[model samples]
Target: MSSEHERGDKKGQFCSIPAKPKCGDCPHPKDYIEVCKPTGWFDHTFKRFVNAKDPFTFEKKFEAHHLVCVAPVTQILLSNDGINSVIEQTKWCINNKDNMIAMPLWGHTVKWYCEVEESISVDEVADVINDAMKAPKFKNIPQHDYDHNCKEGYTWEVEVEVEKLADKVKEQGHKLKGKALEGKLNKLSSDFRSRLLDDRGTRKGGTHAAWKLAQKEPPDPDWCQPFSMASDSKVSSKGFPVRVFNGQVAKWVNRIAKAISSGV
Candidate 1:
């Protein structure tokens, strides 16, 4: 087993943990996951109006073998690198595991965050993000915004695809109102899923990239330099959705721990 001091150099690029070399300068737990709650204006406003409660805390702890990866939840939901970031981080956690590493869990919810040690210019980050957003996964985003519920934030890729289907119908000179349009979308969605259920092509775009990366040979040193969404339905009357905490972190950690113990 590695000493707590040794874990610092082994942490992921975006790890939320305090760096081992710098741990003496901080008071946070050296072995536990740290929830990041930035003090920016957007975050402050959201918490003030939406989720007034403090960040979630977990009663459960991670096993020694766990090498968890955390991503910036806000960036993944709104930035150009959103999809790419999650998939990339997940793959990193999976591919970099060793015998001591087990139950590679990833945190994707809004409260999670990551940082880079090296200084990177905003423009460089934006360029990579723009490229990610332009990937085939988001090809169907309409030229114009069809839904005006920006209060809850932008819709997911699935919603964008449904809107695209509606646009195609409109282009064909067929006007279907309300239920009729809803029915058509339902059918389209069902058909699309049915066809893709057994095909690897269904995982195209960001997911596909992650899948491909996982298949490649592991890095010689098993290390790499660090690089660094919300649903509407549950919106509160405050005009934004409040974050939900339901022991998810504990569940995730336990699931991974179980897998490792079972030799999975």
Candidate 2:
């Protein structure tokens, strides 16, 4: 394994990324995956709020690999160059048995409450989070996570954490939603998710709540068009009205006029 601390020039060890990198990944996606980041934020630096930012953490793609990549985002460097350089130099120190040097070029920092590779779904990464870290003797997240170590006064809100974890699991089931709009719309909180989703909904004039939309349901083919009306009708032998609709409306001008005047 590469020594995270021992590199001669530690300048790029944790590259100071620019506002937006070439890679498309973001710790904050246009629509962040819900539940994963929504819950379990234990504030260490400032007064905590519901859904406050939590320190990022992730399980590496490979068991032995330490370096991983994410897509572009606010904190990533101007490009992948800085992280690429760091990865190259680190390869010399670590065995890099899995040839993970390519990740820096393709990914970004795993700097959210939770994250995974550029292509992996949050569900996949989250599913094995426990198993992947267990054998490696890594800490469990949110509660036991060491990234944002809790001091004596730092509170562990079990109820809030449990809510977030449950919400995260429920969010994974909504993979059909666009990445930009997954978990940001809980009815309960006015945190970032609610705010971001509401703003996005207004900006695009779309339904703010994703679940309220029926994307899989077929469109009403005749919607917005006038409903057909029978130009003429007669009593059938069975006593049911025998109606025929025709496009020759002028033939029934007086009737059509009466129908239109009646608000039919």
Candidate 3:
């Protein structure tokens, strides 16, 4: 995630000049530079793991492996610097031709993924992406004194092995009602993945109500996406000044994962 210079701490701040400038809209560009697109649209995304274990019996349309997704959940920008950082990051994805997705309310591209060669199996995709996150570029962002606008030191990402999780689900027994299985997988989602689907897809009055309601009613088959959990959820607000979002480095990351995990 990127950040902006604090409004109060306007030390080296300049008016945000918006345009497709060479600066790529970085908060305060040291020099005009452009983010390079990667080799190809597929290359831009780092294909993460997919569940290839025993198939989820609930659905026959698409197998478990086909439905399981491992898209990277880009961090939320709590500060101005964070905002700038995500903007730059999204630019990098677009320039690189990756799957750049913009979400509601937040108003920024927050998720990215890769498409592996057709020959690659789900397990292989999982292995490759899991390894890729460890690269120098994808490693966790640590807060530096100069990262002035970040709420905390840095945002961290979690790599979930869908196949392994699926294996566990099988071990736990798959003979369950649609709702029971959905609940079981949902519990796992809360522990691992981003809760964007849980919040936006299942809620009635949130920003994406139309999109959520458009889907078929009742039990959601996709365990990894929205778990078909009910709304009535109350999201606890965690602003920057709020202690819930202060101090500890990973505090905000955890809070973000939890706040969005409404259905779970």
Candidate 4:
């Protein structure tokens, strides 16, 4: 039979031997020798001997073979560098086609045997195997660093400065205490003014009392009053009421008013 058919048969069959014959002492052996097995021998030998090993170990071997088989199919999908290396190796294989088998298992098994036999070093074979295995995952190469920054690209900077300005609102004492006092003063002023308006309307005439009383009633479920001033006033003896007329404070108040008007 042809060598390929003979190898195929050997891998598919099993036969019993009298005993483990010594290579140097066999009577029928000559200077040159060829060992051959019938069809299904390797499969049967594997089932009887190799399968007895731990299942996890056998699974890893199966996975390795699977990776090797899938490698060539994905070679073109890899990067330029990876594709070039595979193309070069394939060209070499083409030139040596007469001496080699192109089947995935044959290629992978030959590579393994070559490395074990020292016909090729482990490192050299490993480089080729690694490139092949990585061919499928080549598209997912990382482009960013761990710090969320780009590599070999633009850099960024932040600048900050501290400066003093005139007429700034400076709370010389405790800021929380100052804000409490200011809130109390605003509440007191609002309550006093509202009371004055009510008394003034009562003194004006009875005609204005109805309108004033209606305004003083709580607002409707859907409609609301524009302002609801608080009724409390407490401030430090040294504190005086001051109103901002310009700059940042005015801008801040304008922003707050706009936000409130937007109902957001």
Q: Top lDDT: which candidate number?
A: 1
Q: What's the lDDT for candidate 1?
A: 0.26
Candidate ranking under TM-score, highest first, comes to 1, 3, 2, 4
* Candidate 4 clashing pairs, residues 3+ apart or interchain: 12-39, 12-40, 12-41, 13-39, 13-40, 13-41, 14-40, 14-41
Each prediction's TM-score versus the true structure:
0.21, 0.15, 0.18, 0.12
Worst 10 residues of 2 by lDDT: 227-236
> Where does candidate 4 stray beyond 4 Å?
1-176, 204-264
Encode model 1's per-residue lDDT on 125-187: one tens digit a residue. 333323432222211111111111234322333345544544554455544433454355345
Alpha-carbon lDDT, every model: 0.26, 0.22, 0.25, 0.21
Instruction: Please give the range of 10 consecutive residues that has the lowest summed lDDT in model 4.
Output: 157-166
Worst 10 residues of 1 by lDDT: 219-228
Tens-place lDDT per residue, model 4, 58-145, is: 2111100110111121221111232223222221110111211111111122223233324434344334332432211111111111
- Clashing residue pairs in candidate 1 are none
How does model 2 score by TM-score?
Answer: 0.15
Cα RMSD to native, each candidate?
Answer: 24.5, 27.3, 24.0, 42.7
- lDDT of candidate 3 over 146-167, digit per residue (tens): 1112232111212133334334
lDDT of 3 at 196: 34
Better of 1 and 4 by lDDT: 1
Per-residue error (Å), model 2, residue 172? 8.2
